[model samples]
Target: MTNYEVRANIRVVFGDGALNELPTLLERHHPKSILLVSSGDYVDDLGIGDAVRQAADSLGATLIEDRGVVPNPRLEHVRELIETAKAHNVDFLLAAGGGSAVDTAKSVAIGLAAPEGTDVWDYFTVGHAVEQVPTLKVGVINTLPGTGSEVGRSAVLTNLATKEKFGVEANNLRPVFTIVDPAFSRTVPQHFQAAAIADEIAHLIETYTADDTDVDITDRLLEGALAGALTNAAKYADDPADDNARKQLHQISLYQHYLNFDRNSDWAGHPIEHVISGDYDLLHGEGLAIVTVAWLRFIAAHKPTKLVQLVSRLYHVDAVTFSEEQVVRGFADHLEALYGRLGLPTKLSAYGIGQEGVDIVAAKVTAGGARTVGNYYALSQEDVRALLSAAL
Candidate 1:
């Protein structure tokens, strides 16, 4: 077995009613005032802002709301959030809602700590001089389970001007505390729920297949997460109010979030999805679902062994009876069917992407460097185009 290292530092409080303990956790961090970060829509729809305000009051911490975050959070939003934090003299950052909100908080935290002369984009796209600033710890009341942004150390930000999305990572980027309450997800519309599940499944599949690590524990955890997400996805699609299904999906999302720690996974699909979303403003999960089937087919041809193992472990199939191609292809078919069942478009054209759109997306993905990173087989621009073509 090869050597592997695992590290989990976040203080995780998981349960059906985890949000109730947010006040205590905030007090433990000793925050005098907190910037409550969220998307404007979720704040009103989910009443997350009100809940955080109440928690802050109970804990004797002043709350400042910054609620303009959107899907594929942008760099300008981070800068604005940093300014808000400074103006409010916030000692802590509280992120509420889904991945976009949590990711925005992480970027804000890093931007505030960054030196005045430095640019935040440099930290994301290119290595630049950065130092951890002394104030502003991070916490989350996660309303969505996808993206695992609450516990992960990296945040994905989009450059709206350039239509590029990239990641930024640092030890200090992880949240100080995260409150995951599955009950909050009960109100998520079935369409969003399906999209979230697609994104979560992509995370598990990419991580599980990317590296050649012999980490048995991580493998089991990844498989369990995929199985749970798959099962719950079907149940939740049929009945969004099923508390049991919602809980299971939340746990699986949380599990995938932590599993990414200390593990090297291919992030190819994310960049591709980012391009589609940035260019077309398509839903993040919907874009991911469209690309995933084609990406899996490419991976199956290039890394048959890994695909076979994943199928055997995740779907509980006997490898001896199922040929590698059949297993790999079957997994792709299953995912396509699932996406269809959940009312997500399975084809690129379904989202208004034709042959020319495919070419544009392929070129952008090539420029993003996803073609080389985390790929078991280095994929060329032609391969990407072919994948897009097949997706159509």
Candidate 2:
């Protein structure tokens, strides 16, 4: 077995009523004041802002709410949040929504700690060195299940001016504490639930298929997460409040979040989906669902052994006996059916993307260097074009 190292430093509280633990956790962190960050919609709908305020009140911590973050969080939004946090003299940051909200909080925290003249793009994409100001402690109350952003050390942000989406990673970006309550995710719209599941599935596939090694622990971890996610996804789609199913999905999401701490592989679907999402403003999970099927097909064609191993492990099949091609095609077909069942569009055309859009997506994926990064099968620009065509 090849040697690997995994490290995660976040304190996690998971259960049916994990959010209720926030007050005590905040007190332990010893933050005098916290900037409560969430989407405007969730401020009232999910009552997340209120919950944070209540927690702060119990802890004698001042709570300042910012409710303007949007899905696929924008760099400008992070800039504004940085300004808000600085002006409020906020001693800590707390995110209380899905991946987007948590990601926004992370970016804002990083930006606030960056040097005065640093550009948001420089911090995210250009790898510019900035003085590490006092790191702000962050706590997350995850209301959504898909992005696994709560325990993750990376945050994806969209640059509106350049129409690009990129992510940044810093150990400090990991939340100091995370609260996972499946009940909160039950309120997510059915369609959004499906998209979230798709995102989780993509995360599994990317990590599972990226390299060839005897990393049994990582393999089992990835496969278990995939199986749990798929099983819970079906039940959640039928009945969102199915506590058993919600708990399983929540566990899978949390597992994927911690999986990011290990250096297993590169994120294949993310770069492609980022470009498509940046251009079309598509839902992140839905975009992932659309791109992943194509990516799987491409990888299977080029790396049959790896594909067979993944399929065998994920589905508990005999790798030697199962026709590799059939397994690969079956996986894609299954995902397509899941997308349709979840009321998500299965093809680019379903989203009104045409031939020109396909070419644009192809170029963007290549430019992002997604096809080359730790992929078991290196993909050329033509390969990316073919995948785009297949997705269309």
Best by TM-score: 2
Instruction: Put down candidate 2 lDDT per residue, 97-205, tens digits, no spaces.
Output: 8899899888877787777797666877878642254558888988778788888878899987888998877677888899987777767778777888899888987
Consecutive 10-residue window with the lowest summed lDDT within model 1: 127-136
**Candidate 1 local lDDT, residue 32:** 77
Candidate 1 residues 1-392, lDDT tens each?
33455555688888866777877888888877889877766556666666778878887888888778887888998888888788888888888888888888888877777777866777787775333554257898887877777787778888889878777666678788888888787777678778888899999988877555656777888888888888888887787789888878777777786675545677778878887888887778999998888888877766768778878877787778877877898899998888888999989888788999888877877864354534555666777888889888
- What's model 2's TM-score? 0.93
User: Scored by CA lDDT, what does every candidate get?
Assistant: 0.79, 0.78
Give the residue spans of candidate 1 off by over 4 A: 1-5, 41-47, 129-135, 211-213, 260-263, 316-322, 368-371
Report the CA-based lDDT of candidate 2 relative to the real structure.
0.78
Judge candidate 1 against the unseen true structure and give its global Cα lDDT, from 0 to 1.
0.79
